[model samples]
Target: MKKITIIASLLALSATTFAQTWSVDKAHARLGYSIKHMTLSDSEGNFKAYDAKITATKPDFSDAKFDISIDVASLNTENDMRDKHLKSADFFDVEKYPTITFKSTSFKKVNGNQYKLVGDLTFHGVTKQVMLNAVYNGTQENPQSKKLVAGFTITGAFKRKDFGFATEAPATMLGEDVNLRASGEFVKE
Candidate 1:
């Protein structure tokens, strides 16, 4: 009976190992996107620094775990003036808040190829629950890096005012609702 129990335990452990997990390979990962400003065309940009970790029970992503960290101080809008404006207290307040982050609170498979990701997003100094229309871009192995990687894209909007961003432009200029797009690529450690 003891031997049988030990065998069962081993099987359970091995089964758990079957769960696929990927670590963020910063060199190959991207954490960025932009939104339309002035109700005109979308302005493009990206975060200079970020990391992520994701785990999937299978490629379908029915069962998964996800988390990401972004250095708020790394916001680079390309233009020196715009980047300075974004880092100010009127925006992200890089001096006060050095980092912004998101961690999955829950996940649900909404459809065959879509998912609802519920997570806490921290910005400025406030934490808010944000839901994302997420997509599983699937998984692959990089022959060069020899690392297993998984990718995802998340889209949502946030109230910059909620995080005390730009006290001056709550209604104009920067706009209150900031569009957010996160694309992450994680590799197996």
Candidate 2:
């Protein structure tokens, strides 16, 4: 009986000290991107529907894993015609590739509150390794929900041609580089 009680206590303690899972608060998150248009202006857009989760064993999140998926059809740039064109065969071809996903390979601390996130990004029927700069915006307890939450801002850039995305578009019409930015609050799960 005594041994059983001790074992149970240890298990409880380990559970609290081990890996923790966190889910993004969709209402407080944004997945956005920007690209040069006509070599003159920048066109910006965002995916309204997406999901992300994080797993971490360290308090500082130095050993964290991240997974995210974005609904390709949920993209919006506030211009219906342009958005439709972007979803067509000239670009994303949403019907063929309905989602864009990323799974982290490594998360290494670069400096105070900064980290390098290396991951495999699958987009437009292609997968490639990419690195993003991450800033850990810290954690806090929600005043109303009383749950622990963490904040992060991740940014990266990739060439559209590299992913076979709208490869036919000339640089004079649409720039090749796509800049990505995601920021959000994640709730402990």
Candidate 3:
């Protein structure tokens, strides 16, 4: 009986110390991208709907699991015609592929607050491994909800041609590089 009690107490302690889940605060997050338009200037757009599921074993976010998804139909370039064109078969083909998703395979700390997040990104019927340079923007207790929250900013660039997004638009019309920037905040659950 004494041995059983000791084992139970140890198990309880471990669970409290290591098990934690964090959920993305969608209201405070933004996923956006910028690309050169016709070699003239950069055009920026954002997705209106997205969500994230994050699990962390450490407060500094080391050895964390991250998954995020963005609604392809929610993409907006601020122009009605342009937005529709982007969602058509030429671009995202939202009717066929409705969401762009990422599932982290690894997270490695690169210095103080910087980390490299390696993940499988799926979009437009293609899946590829990508890496994002991430900066942990620190964490604090939210004054409104009184919950512990952490924020991160991540950036990466990829070639549109690599994902089969190049067939419709020529290089002269749309730049090959598509740059992404995301700011996400997760509240400890």
Candidate 4:
């Protein structure tokens, strides 16, 4: 009984040592998206307020979990009038849905730095499954902050209609696909 208790304690300690939490460095991170504008050009925008909660058991982040949130009111495209319109009922409807969130369902490493992340994205009061291609930029000690940091780039595309996002423009004018591209820096907590 004594030997068994000692082994169980050691296993618990090992699990605790491997668990880690990471907080998004919002100053060094960005959550952005791009969509076809008038079917002629790409209109790019980013959210100014957002955060990512990350937890992992391995440094490679193969088994990492992610929970991210973005304030809908923080959407910016460098055009004031258009930005306002985007926040109205015709688009994001920031008044009713102030935030967009994502929670990871699975994270699987594909290659050295490439991974496939499956998650549920909630936006515009609708929740849908999404798959994102993620590339881990690896972890390093910050020279100035002296804290451990990890970087990752995530890219994916989803149909806006799937999330109940509809606009006045026709499909020919405004594309249905919303492409998401973001790079985030996380500080060890």
Candidate 5:
């Protein structure tokens, strides 16, 4: 009877593990980023097209995995002429490299509701691994839309020169670092 009880407990634990997997809707990813402008302000932009595959459960994300991609050509800054210039060879060079991608290498829980996400970021024909310190702003059941909603604020920085974005506009001001800040959300379908 003791041996039978042990087997039963093990089975119960296995069932709990099987129930922990969760899949978020790929269409619900909100991706945006900001870069310093003229060393005085920040210029914000977001890609309107992208995809994500996230597997995570509420409260505990140890088993979670995340993958994200952004279309370089879909970059929009709310100005038509400026947008076209940005898409040219001097900037993103979207014609040569069409997509920017991120594949997670590792993630670790920080303090409350936060995780340090380390991933590879590819842009402008360059691939560099970066870390996104993100805060998990809790998941909620939307009252109006009736879907699981999750939000995150990811703050990080990268040097513009690393990806061949060495614009002399900053050199005129004797500035070298191009800080970046990205924040967004994800929802369950």
Candidate 6:
């Protein structure tokens, strides 16, 4: 019994040692989106405020879990009038839904530096499962900060109407699909 207890304690210690927490380097990250407008051109925008974090036990981050939250009021399309309209009840309804959040359920390795990320996304007061293609851009030491950091890029698309956003807009006025692209560098904490 004494020998068994000793082995169990060592195992627990090893597991704890491998676990790591990574925090987003906000200045090195961005969350942006694009959607077709007027059935002609694509309108692009990005959120100015957001937070993201990752937790992993593997060196390759194959078992990483991600959590992210975006401030809806921080949305900007470079057009003041359009930005205001988007924040109103006609679109995002920022008063009712102040934020959008995502929590990863699975992060599966696909090929070299490629992964499939599945998660639950809560947007516009509705929650739904979403999948995104993730690319592990590798890890390296930041020259200035002298810290270990990991880089990643994630992309996906979902229907705006599915999230109860801009439901009244016609197809000719605004496309149903919203394309998302986010990239960030995370520093081990």
Best by TM-score: 6
* Cα-based lDDT at residue 74, candidate 1: 79
What local lDDT does model 4 show for residue 54? 89
Question: Clash totals for all models, in order?
Answer: 2, 0, 0, 0, 0, 0
- Candidate 6 clashing pairs, residues 3+ apart or interchain: none
Pairs that collide in candidate 5 are: none
Candidate 4 per-residue lDDT, tens place, 18-132, comes to 8999999988899999999888999899999988988999878989999999999999999999999999999999999999999999999998899999999999999999999
**lDDT (CA) for every model shown?**
0.76, 0.95, 0.90, 0.93, 0.70, 0.95
**Residue-by-residue lDDT tens digits, candidate 6, 20-69:** 99999989999999999998999999999999999999999999999999
RMSD of each: 3.0, 3.6, 3.0, 2.0, 4.9, 1.7
lDDT of 2 by residue, 51-158 (tens): 999999899999999999999999999999999998998888999999999999999999999999999999999999999999999999999999999999999999
Off by over 4 Å in 3: 1-17
Compute the lDDT of residue 123 as modeled in candidate 1: 77
lDDT of predicted model 2: 0.95
lDDT of 3 by residue, 39-108 (tens): 9999899999888877877878898888998999999989999999899998888999999999999989
lDDT of 6 at 36: 96
